[model samples]
Target: MAECVACKQSSMAQYTIHNVRFFDFNPKAIHCMSYDDATSRLALSRTNGDIEIWNCWSRPFMQLFLPGDNDSSVEAMVWCQGRLFSAGLHGFLLEHNLASREVTLRTPITGGPTWCLALSKDKKKLAAGTERGYVCIFDVVDSGVMYDRALEKQEGRILHIAWHISGDYIVTGSVNCVRVWSLKEGRVARCGLGAADRKDEVIVWCVGILDDMTLVSGDSSGRVCFWNAELGTVTHSVHTHKADILALTVCPDQKSVYVAGVDPTIVQVSRVETGTKKGKVEMWVKGIQRSIHTHDVRALVVTATDRVYSGGVDTILTLSYFPPRTVCKFPALPPLGSISVAREAESLLLQYSDHVELWRLGASSKKGGKSGTFLPVTKDRVKLLELQGKDDEVIQWCAVSPKARWIAYLVQGSLRIYHFTPPASGKQPRVQRVKEVSQEIKKSHQMLWLSEGKLVSAAVTGAIQVINVSGSKAELEKELTLSPGHSVLQMTCDLEGKMLAVVDSKNIITIFDIEKETISVLPGHSSPCTAVGIHPLTKEVVAVYADMSIKEYDPSKQCYTAFCRQHLNEPSSELAKKHSVILRVSFDPDRPDLILLHNESAFVVVQKDKMAADVSQEKAPKVKKVTSGSSPGKGAKAGIGAKFSVIRRPNQVLLFSQMKGEAVVSVELNPLQVMDRLPSPLKVKKYGGT
Candidate 1:
């Protein structure tokens, strides 16, 4: 619920359709605001007087903070003529160079309450609306403040103002009528907004002139009215608020109108429509909290994508997501990380930095609710999966056992296993740690199952330990050490679990005959090895190293067979500096010849059959002796700081055919935004459920 300035909580009934998730989108107040010249960027002021520019697509592009002055609050902002203009309570009115990140303060519009600003389309003139009912116009390019005798009298404690597209006329909205003044004329051409015959209070708060012949204005009475420039008469009027209307703007296409008011509601009306009743014109009202102004909507600006930006009392701004004929709404937050469909539980699970959650599918989230609709689960049906004994470990990888009754996780020193039992009644499942395999292996890289009950765990110290968790006493069955001198980064076993492949820091992958207890070393890698994969059915192995090299090794032939170097979309010769490190690789279970490799910025799916023949036909060196860098007993102590605990299934590679897998769902995480709180100043408005 949105808390009132008086500290009262909004009644549940009053906010039954409210979405708190959307309200917290931005936790900061919005000062000056503007849409870019192309309307594809949004710029706003931080309390520190710095300006942050975000692409129209909801991505932040750049930030410009004032260097010397730290506490200036930007009260006004606008983008025009390829530059960003900002003014604030400080004595500074600055023009910023966007491309070079430079700042130049024009003649200081020094005053205590400068709060509003606008720029002409041609970029020749700048206007600052101030707290004293006056506005200052400057020649922007020349850095001239234009304070000649001709410009002094027009100054008043102006609340809001707008520049004509031609840059010849200026419209200033005060506590009364809309004043349209021509620069050359130096006088108001019309002031008919508050004629004696008009019934509404004439405290004009904001003005948005649509064209030379028409304009719109909002006043203290919470009423909005359209005016005809040619006739100098009010054309139509609409009661848009329960309180005073503070800000007004024309829709993107100028076919309709939008007004923000003290009621915390933004009213949209067709230019030709008139009425204050509900559903008369499209309308959206959401609770807003700001201390400086009570629900008093302050700023409004519309940007690309029919997005509307509104700011108010809470000092917060909101961005509304409105589609076509539907009222404006906001994006509902799913659980945290990418969600995937869970197989055993038949639910959607959310994964984050340290948590895994299960959520029951909601009725509306199914195809049954709407054709082609994909909803993960109901927000209220979420459950947290807490792993015992894995409290401070910060799990990095996890795999479920084949049976799905147990989960295997590698922590620090040893392998810890947890057993899960499905709920007998309509309750959550109970999970408990029932098995542990202690290994002196520090920083385990990968863990895979050999047979139904046997598992292989690879450590960073180039050692592999085979553990049997079937009996009461969990114990290691086999221990194989790679060079014993180099560090192991990754390891994987063939589908039959007979051959194990381990890659060391020197990019050398040593193949071990698990049954024979022997090793075959393959070298020639210039970078640290990152990923290795073995065919499930075939004894063939595919290794991808740090130099971005991919090779196929055959154990049966006892040699390297083929190399697929520099496949399609390879980087340019000059740009291909240090090779990219391969992070992960996997072979398709159904298509043995199809391999997938994931690197830092690229994902490649290749067919092994089409790969070129091995370039490495050279005979490899044979090691007649196995010598540990510091001897076996001393190397064994390398696992001193290693620790392990079973972790819940990870969502990264959701469903690996050969491994027990979980489902995945999608969630969004863009650090909280302040503009997401304000009502979009222009076209469409989005709505969230009550």
Candidate 2:
């Protein structure tokens, strides 16, 4: 923990990196992320016109696909009722329905691109800021637009907006100024143009409304400003990030504010009572530190449960915990090109453009490091293989078998499978293409191993083909065809390998039962289906659609139920709709109920019973809830109906729990600690001398 000189009078809160999640899609940049307090879901918007939603506790649940040819990057998104209202580069507010999986409505608004958005506390009003310096306010009811008004213009694009908790005012950040708008008057109430001493025009990148009504704004100048929301004057300002501050969030307690941005640092600003003035409080930088993200931090949301979630340019999602002050990292996915993870071999195979590289994870060292130091030592990394392709052709997708003995990749609309030979005594292993098979399938998009000898593939021609590889020959076994215009997007097989779930371009989930040799089409989505997964325990099919909706289809019942509807209250319906389409769903190997959903931006972990309540009622063991205060904003509602609690541990800490007079102990070892214990030549160098 780094101490802030200005916060000497205040006590700092310890924060650690809890978890990091990496995205599969290579986004140019992550624009923003919004958290729904009602459903505990997080929505992420990217530069590629993609919006994704994740169950706050689980992986990605859905993604929203643009409805028309005018696909523009989403700039700002807000949730209302059961729909997501997004304004972006297309200059139109798109209303996406989570239940129906469709763009229910689209309305043209002022400005070429809407940059920021905020929803009122009561969920009735919405405010959007645009590239043309206009602030648009709208009345939302029953997931439909009632009316909209564009306020008087500012000078530059509106980059950030936050509605006051009271729902009477909205604070907006734009080029060179921060302004407060009155909801009742429908006009600007107050405006602060930053420090008069500053000569350069500062672009405000993020804003947050605190509990005490003070407005916090982070700008490109790397300064965080605190203003009196009503008076519209700068109360205090502090230099925070080294680069642009892109993300900001107010803690539910209202006592602290979290900020992150272009720099890798995350700063926590807290309000402390002034010693000289008994009743007055001042903002202080209580904690400042860096996380594992290697790039610009773009989006942040402090959930109602008090956990801080951050998404960054590195394509990773990091969770920061408070009491333990620990950080955890989750990587979204392998880069967009071609990549495959061999869990059993502990290796990663990646293809960038025309070059392929294989990386192996080294075994953990038995050594230990100094008690309180974190050093960046290169872990055992070995580049085992490199394959170069023709300059014009690139690997589009790739997959490795469970044991990593067989490798398959797609290039130039052709699928190729190769046998990987392990290195023998004093000899290096090599890869050899089996045999050239006739191209019976046209335009292959994705391929995966169904078994050690079987491969499943989806193509643009709306066909799912299963191929059998015996020794050196490849033979097509079966081909399943969808409707003429529907193309396969993603596919996954059940744990038993008897069933396969396929999501197609037409937003339908098709389940192929191997035993019956029959296909059952589950139709409910309104947009294209991105991903599908079969529950390991119950074998129910959970499908994520482009309109940001997640549904579970029970083949036995022949019925579909909204996955997240029962877990969240009515207010969260709007949040459920604001998520992007879910690109993938994965079940934990050890826990069948634990599912991970991911898209381009972030991934979340959710339990089956909590999300798919219609499927089962076997509840997870409940833990004691902890609270900071009796007030609702405090810890009163934190994780109110949550199924899981976050636990953080230090590198050397041991936790002991007592249940019914029985003690259970768990020990955790940090990866760095293991590396430090190793007698490696790299550890002999001085700390700062290169």
Candidate 3:
């Protein structure tokens, strides 16, 4: 054992060194020991299932009795009045009375040996830790035992215990963790000892309550660390034990402490004389190994009579009267405010900062007080990926390829491909470098990836570039220039990437056979074709006209048909029916049957069959409502009476129409939301609408 330089109490040695001796009356292993502050009586558990009670004030007041002959070994001991509670392996709990030496047994607990045991300060409840790595609380009654609760947090066994000063809560060390639990709430208050690093692991074993909201724990490495509960801080740490620390106890005056372990011969007395000053403890060691027992010492207890009681493998009770000394050094670390625990492969992860962190949980835990170690969570740990574009060359739209491995980005005047790593790889994300080879075309407003690694790029200059990307290097295999006055604007591709459909400067859609490298422009609409999409599985091209009309191009019939139209037309026959035009058209990637059409004022959901029915049913309402005449009565007018009339316009139903003109004039109408003013024809038509 070693002395801590902080929070030490100064105590002088009262007993002489010559007095250290042991009386070997019994020969058995000691499992657990305890002291009753109220009665000044100390209880000791022996390997043969016997408990030895000693009156610390008396020189030779020691009595031994058998509790039970259970097969399991005793793990912990708690005392109340003349009764003793013992937790043993295989969930064995035996109660024995010192007065009559009568043994009474309670219900079986969980599984394996009880790793930790604690009795409330008032002796109203008893908590037992099981090898199953969970905590069970039992209420202590006069006649028998009653079930209380179980704590479910730590993934391993609990090994240490320390009750809060208020007797309202308790903390236990288990599986490299220190957990605080509230008796009133019946839940975990906090868990500590977290690590962020992926490597070094630690566990907490024995814990001692230094004050109301402060405690200290000794881990497997024989390190004693202090923590404050209110403020999360590790004030100090001292390596005090050469072997695992078995137990910890606070000094009577609440200033000093006593620790015992493998070095049985020497009992280290740590006294805090100076307040948080370095080298404050006046260190002294007493040869109490022989006095504790004839065998290895396992447990120790401090009695109210100012005497120390020890139990060991020799099954003997050792007592000594020792005086205290004052020693002082640095203060202990503050208690941890919060803790986050996570489980990783074979290791437990712990986080102790304001934010949660990730770590691997280690295997071993000392006496149970180890809060596993963890690292901090920082922004640098997480990376972000972003793609930027030029001022006017904004990314108008984006679509992932059929395989979901490649993404096609449509810019103001060009197309780009980005290849991404699949999720199965479990590696950092990366994007492919797009090879720009569209020099033949001034600029592509849109592009689509077709089958056989072919891409069709459309420019506003009535030119299209068909490039093949099957090879590592991109090659312009074909170029298709549209007729004069025909420039492409929006485009789409089918699911198999076999066919490409694009809307040109005029309200005409051009369907191209990617494999055959052929393009055909189908003239059908009077206004510009604002958007284009295709049925991925069916290879059907869907075109949206500036008049809000959807037309499908039938490849076998080689004819245009009214697919669908929005009922948003004004009364003026010259004005187009579609308000502000359909700016975007897309087919549901997941549901091939659904099509989405969005414009400035409204959005439309179109299905193949429903769209056909909507178009076929388009017809003007016949009746028109109008005020024929209004006459003034006597209450309305005492003078000359007058008649008034109001005219109501008939609602015009939008139906299928043909775009038969010399040149299919198409214009990319600006979305109404951003348009400064409506066209004179459109404004006049809107005023004439019902």
User: Candidate 1 regions off by >4 Å?
Assistant: 1-26, 47-50, 57-70, 98-102, 110-112, 142-156, 193-202, 229-233, 273-296, 313-690
lDDT (Cα, tens digit) per residue for candidate 2, span 98-215: 4333466888777768878888888888888888888888888774776578888877888889888888778888878888888788788888886678788788888888767788
Best by lDDT: 2
Model 2 CA RMSD to the hidden true structure, in angstroms:
14.9
Which 10 successive residues of model 3 have the least lDDT summed? 1-10
Q: What do the candidate models score in CA lDDT, each in turn?
A: 0.51, 0.61, 0.48
* lDDT computed for candidate 1: 0.51
- Candidate 3: global Cα-lDDT? 0.48
> How much is 141 displaced in model 1, in angstroms?
1.6
Query: Which is better, 2 or 3, measured by lDDT?
Result: 2
Of 1 and 2, the candidate ranking higher by TM-score:
2
lDDT (tens digit, per residue) of candidate 1 on 1-690: 110001001111010111111112222344456777464567766543445554432222222222213344677777765467777777567777443234645556734467677777777677776766566677665553454222334434667778888777777777556777777777677765477776755677788877555767888777777777556577777776766777776766766666777666776766433367664663222222212223556667765455676665455445664554322221222211123333334343333324444343222222222211223333443343645333454333454444345455644324665565656678978776644455443445456666545677766445677877654345678788756456544466665668888765444778888898877776565444446777776767777543455666677776666433333223222113323334456554555655655432222445444332221333213312222121111111111000100011111112222121211121222222433455444232348633
Question: What are the per-residue Cα lDDT tens digits for candidate 3 across 468-571?
Answer: 66424466777776667665544666656667776543446778777787666665655445567776555666776544445666554565543423422222
Model 1: number of clashes? 55
